[model samples]
Target: MLILKLTNITKEYNSRVILNDINLSCKNCEMIAIKGKSGVGKSTLLNIMAGLERATSGEYYYNEILMNDKSINSLSKFRQANVGYISQHSPMIPELTVLENICVPVWFEKDEEKKKEYMQQIESLSMLFEINNLLDKKINALSGGEIQRAGIIRSILKKPQLIIADEPTAALDDETALMILTHFNFLKSEGAIIIVVTHNDIVSKHCDKTYQLSKEGLLLIS
Candidate 1:
């Protein structure tokens, strides 16, 4: 099964140690939560997991491949092929329609088969997030919760093996947040690994496992 393992992962900036000797592991079809107080480097750790940043020391393995020493280009390719990220605000281009922003990543697929798959995913995910009707609206016209739902569809459009979400339901109300969590469980059942970094108890309580991040490292608190 798809496996992600981090061993002795460490990060430093200038002279500050953000993550120190952290270790974590996750397998397919699992939804995990990472919780921590502000300034505890939760986002930094997510960056490393999403390949947006590299750990200064230690190894990161996906399945059986070692990613610690891969070139920047290779890492970029890896992210494109295997990682999906849902950010706090669900970054979108203000000028683009929700549909356009969601399709930006796979708008020009060379493979007809792949294109069809993405199209189907968009349709299905839009329904799941209940955002199909908002597709025609410009990003600037949508509310925070609506934008967050659209962002979720965009992030998973490619069906990446690893899904990295940072406070995905922060802007959503309780109902919408539960809807998001339900879909996360659905994704897990479909064999995708979901890593969520959130401080929301409702969100954390829904995950299969929970870990707390600190300067000391990552620890399983539940």
Candidate 2:
């Protein structure tokens, strides 16, 4: 049931090593948090796993399929189908309406029935995240917290098997942060593997497991 595995992964930038010999694995429905100070390779590692960046060494496997240079296209397709990512800054399209933003992923589905199904799921997620009333509003009109919540809802609309969130709660107040984490917990109950990279202790403590990244590399902290 292991959904992700990283073995001896290393990343470098302009000859500077960022991550070194990192190995990690997580099972289906597991929740893990990655924590570190600003300069550590937390986001780098997440990007590697999500196929947004390549590791200079080692290998990755998603659902037991080897992921590497040879599998780039396949990996990208797989990620689009099964992985959802949320970054610290919500990436909603400025011109898209809230409902349109949520439905963006559904446009990739080839099946008419599946596309319609996902549209309905997006509607339900909008209500659950308390953005149903904002569905008609343009993304530029939303407050910071509202946009963040919309990002979360849009990411999960496809029910991706794995969710990677980078500093998702960093911009929110304590109450709002907790509410967002609670929504992640609810997603966990439905058997999604949630991996969050954050510097906040509050967010780290809420995860089922925690890892710390540093110049030395990744360490299991909880």
Candidate 3:
């Protein structure tokens, strides 16, 4: 079983401490929700968890493997292999078509077999997220909700073990949000570890565990 363990994780910006001695532990198949007011370092915590940012003074371990000490290149490899990150806004190239943008993550896959599987997954996920019809549209042409769905498809198409999302449903209507979360449920059942930072209670309701982050750190909420 894959396990994610953060031990005494702390983040500092200049002299300010963003995350203070935070600790968390979980394994695959668990969906976790982190709720907090804006500007409480929620995104910072998510970045640290996703290996996009290094913790100032702590240990981050995935299945007993140390991640804090890895070099930039090693960290990049780690993220490429294990992470599916959904940023709050679109991270796609404005000039690219939605389908091309969605295929960005696996554009370098040299294996012919994996390429076929990736194409199959792209088709399924695009249809599942209701963005197949918009595939030819440029990123700059799509609405916020459409871009959000496309972003979701791109992050998850690689079948990552860690799904880190920052306000994933902010731009979508409730129905569309439910559609995406329902798919997240399927991913969870398949042993993916999902972590979402959201202010919406509707998002929390779908998770197995919920926590509120404060200046002090993570606090469990029921």
Candidate 4:
């Protein structure tokens, strides 16, 4: 089923156009990579999809609901419930331990039973990602790859319907990046819309489809 659709989306800064007349449609169980050189608006496109930024013009629909007109509070609630965003930068909070940082997404759950269930899932995910040993350590203690893997685990623990990952494997070595991409494939099979923004060929190659962003807009490369 189609989970996301964008029509003639345009984003600009002052007089500078970053993305112009872009159109995209994504379905469940699909992995899409947005690729571009450093100055292109790959990250900006992901941010806009994640509702962290707004386009100057055009339409965005999530699950057939119009997101362009949704209130900030409404969008925030939607994102909290259905969207998992792994940003380009480390998502870890310095004050929180590794486990605590991973649990942040479910922290607001008021239902005791659901919260307990989420915690159990978190533990399982940590073990799968091989981060169980570092759960008690501080965020500062883990290596970059460890932190990125943990961040990915955190994002997926909630089993969000749409996962927007920005440069998720940007800093990892080949082995680690492949490991993360494998997990992303698993998520895709489980019916999640995985959108990754990256410059890496390995990351893009693993995705089901790749789109390139330029001043003119998004173009399908695969």
Best by TM-score: 3
TM-scores, each model vs. reference: 0.96, 0.94, 0.97, 0.95
Instruction: Assess each prediction's global lDDT (C-alpha) against the native.
Output: 0.90, 0.85, 0.90, 0.87
Model 2 C-alpha lDDT versus the unseen true structure: 0.85
lDDT of prediction 1: 0.90
lDDT tens digits by residue: candidate 4, 34-151: 9888878888888888887778899999989888877888888888888889876666798889999988878799999989989998888888878999999999999998998888
Cα lDDT tens digits, model 1, 113-184, are 998899899998998888898899988888899999988888888988899999888888999999988988
Ranking by TM-score: 3, 1, 4, 2
Q: What is candidate 3's TM-score against the reference?
A: 0.97
lDDT of 3 by residue, 1-222 (tens): 999999999999998988898889989999999999898889999998898989999999987899898898988988999999997786889888999998997788999899889889999999988889999988888888889999898899889999999999988898888998999999999999999998778889999999989988898895
Model 2 lDDT per residue over 1-88, tens place:
7578999999889999999999999988688999888878888898888888888999888888777674678768877887889988
Q: In model 3, which residue pairs have backbone atoms overlapping below 3 Å?
A: none
Q: Any idea what lDDT model 4 has?
A: 0.87
**Which portions of model 4 show Cα errors greater than 4 Å?**
none
Instruction: Give me the runs in candidate 1 sitting further than 4 Å from their true place.
Output: none
Worst 10 residues of 1 by lDDT: 103-112
